[model samples]
Structures are given as structure tokens and as C-alpha cells.
Target: MDKNILGNNVITQIGILVHDIEKTSQAYADFFGIDKPDWSMTDTADIAQTEYRKQPTQARVKLAFFDMGSLQLELIEPDHNPSTWREYLNEHGEGPHHIAFVINGMKGKVAMMERNQMPLLQKGEYTGGRYAYMDTFNDLKIILELLEND
Candidate 1:
């Protein structure tokens, strides 16, 4: 097992891959009885390609972030073309995609993973966080993340 002490800013976020962002966003909003979280958009294919992961054959995605108490829930849907999430939905439907664990000392952690031959599947900086993805059990299904303190 891997062992590392996460910094105080560490936050845990869950990612839900969905077919409809609005529907999923509403569900969470209604459940929480709070205003829907904000939205974010990006074309992550470039980064995926660099990591040798499946290239997203989509234009972009409409992603919404929902705050649930302390954790943030991310809902993703392809706004154009198709994506890995879309494919996952086509095959399995909406469900949990991954869990993001925010942390500090990211570079140090990443280096350790590398020295142990468990280099991240993908790594990059975004939204005040340095993010890295590592698959659970060598399976590409679940992504384990290390997010920098933000």
C-alpha cells in the first residue's frame, strides 16, 4: 500500500460521469436544496494524448461542480462530439468515475510514486491545483488522484 501524509488543505472531491449535466446537477442541487454549483469547460484530449490515454474524440465537455457540505461533486457531460465519459455512459450509464484527493507536496509525492514505478497515468496543473491520476489495480476504470493544496 502507498503511504503519504496529506497536507492540511487536502480536500476530497468525487467525480460523477454523466450523460446529462443539467439533470445530474439538478438532482444534487435539489438534494442539497442549495444553488447549483458553478460550471467549467475544457478539452482534455491534448493532455490525454500526452499521457497515452484514450484521446477524447469530442469538442469539449460541460462540467458542473456541486458543493456538498465540505466535498465537491463534479458532474461531467460531453457538450460536443463524444468522450470517454460518454462512452462509459453508453456502456454502463451514469455513475462514479473517480475520487480526487486534494493534497500538498504534490511533486514530492509524484516523485515517490515514480521511484516506486507507479507513475501517474496523467499529471497537470489546473484551477490552483496540481493534479495527477493513477489507476487502481492497473485498471483504467477507477482513477486515484493527488490534488495539490488550493
Candidate 2:
């Protein structure tokens, strides 16, 4: 079977790290003149500690999502302990953390990456979608994904 390669699909969403979810959401709302999208918080302690290789210890995140016309934007903030987002913010201020794509097979994709020595940042199912993260670059950066419902 041909292993599905990364970037073989469209980027459905991009997660931007921010310190303030509401304020950041507002900025996007005003900038795009669109209403704020739904928001939620996740513990992520276990997922972060286990899955994310470059993640800071005890990683916690407060995230919000915004629908931008044809795409979606996710705003994330690292709390509890510092995270890749915090580090990125410290180095370059608020900006893109990871670009998420919709994939055909998430587990298979992740397994392929694993066999290739690329570690997964996280792997689990949420809201009926399979998600995973992997860091291939040196900057502790990674790609996020959403698997098509099987």
C-alpha cells in the first residue's frame, strides 16, 4: 500500500497560539468582522506528557475556534506549564503554531510516521474526529491532523 504522505490534503484549519483566547478571538472578530466562534478548554496533561515529544511538562491549553469563511482558525494558549505555544510566543509573539489538515487515515498515517521515526505529539479521537501531531522539523514545530470518519 502507498503510505499517505503529509500535505496530501487541504489544510482545514490552522491553530494559532495566543495568551488570551477572548481578546485574541475578539481581534479576529474585529479584523474579519465576523462573530466569535466557539471556545473550549482541555487539560491535555496526559496527552501532552505522553504524545507530544517537544511539549513542555504538564502542558495545558485553552483553545478557541473561529470559522473564517471557508476555513477554521484555532486559538490556543498554554497554561499550567509552558508549552510549544508559550515558547513560540516568547520567541516571536503570537503566531501560527501548527497547520492542521484533513486526512484519509489518521491512524495509518500516524503509524507510517512512527515507522519513519517521526514521533507523534498526540493521538486521540475528539468530537468524532481522529487527531494526531508529529514533529519532523528541528524547531519543535509539528503538523496537526483530522482523519476522515471511517
Candidate 3:
């Protein structure tokens, strides 16, 4: 396996699962003295075509982004549906969820992740891109989110 498969370890974002998006966004902004970012809901089931644990699902979440130079901090608040975010929040509570890397080819990267013992847990389509959550917690202590822009 190539050690540079993830492309130089450039992490574009750090995702955190939260119970309340408004509250958490306020807390982060207030604590850091930065402006609170507006949160937005993800795409609907029809557009997203989300899959969780190998099954078609309608799971969605609200997302807020805090830009800090090159690294973005993403806050996620999931609805009461079946999803990787819900599973993590339920099992681990509000905390760090995943670290994301923007890659070129998602299919190849996913295969590499799987070959490295990190199987895919969930995936979904966004407006201009798609994302996959790799089950790397056992090895890396956090899920790996691979974003592929189209």
C-alpha cells in the first residue's frame, strides 16, 4: 500500500457531532470571539441519495462551518434518523466525529481505505460533491471523511 494514498495528509476539515447546532455554534463563536456562522440543512433524500450501513436511508443533518485559515471546523447536528452521525452522537455523545480530506477520485480512495482495513460506513451526495465516511475509528480513533468534488 502506498503511504501517500491520502495525498500528503492534508486535512481540510475537522467534523464534530453536536446535539444542538445553534447552541454549539454560539458557544464556539463566543468562546473564540468569532462571529457565529449560519447553519444549513443538508440536501433531501431524493437529491442526496444517502446510504447508511449499506441500506438506503433518509438521514439528514444541519451543518455549520467555521473557517480558520486553511482548516475548517464543521459542526454537525443530525436529525432523529439512521445515519453515521446519529450513531456516533448516540454512542459517543457530542464530540469529535471525523477528519476530512478532499481527494480527487473517490472510488479509488474508498478502495484504498477499505484495503487498509477501514471499510465505508456511510456515504451521500451533496450539491457539488459527494462524501464517504470510513470506519477508521478502530485504527485511527476517528472516522475519515473523504470528499470528492465533481
Q: Pick the candidate with the highest lDDT.
A: 3
| Candidate 2 segments whose C-alpha is farther than 4 A from its true place | 1-7, 43-50, 54-58, 82-92, 138-142, 146-150
lDDT, residue 39, model 3: 99
What RMSD, rounded to one decimal, does every model reach? 4.2, 4.0, 1.0
Write down the TM-score of every candidate: 0.68, 0.72, 0.96
Candidate 1: segments with Cα more than 4 A from true spot: 5-11, 43-60, 79-91, 114-119, 137-141
Q: Can you write out model 3's per-residue Cα lDDT over 4-110, one digit (the tens) per residue?
A: 77775899999999999999999999999999999999999899999998899999999999999999999999999999999999999999999999999899998
Cα displacement (Å) at residue 68, model 3: 0.8
Looking at model 1, report the run of 10 residues with the lowest lDDT sum: 49-58
Q: lDDT (CA) for every model shown?
A: 0.64, 0.67, 0.94
Q: Using lDDT as the measure, what is the rank order of every candidate, best first?
A: 3, 2, 1
Q: Evaluate residue 67 in candidate 2 and report its C-alpha lDDT on the 0 to 100 scale.
A: 76
Question: Residue 43, candidate 2: how far off, in angstroms?
Answer: 5.9
Clashing pairs in 3: none
Which of 1 and 2 is the better model by TM-score?
2
Worst 10 residues of 2 by lDDT: 47-56
Angstrom error of the Cα, residue 5, model 3: value is 2.3
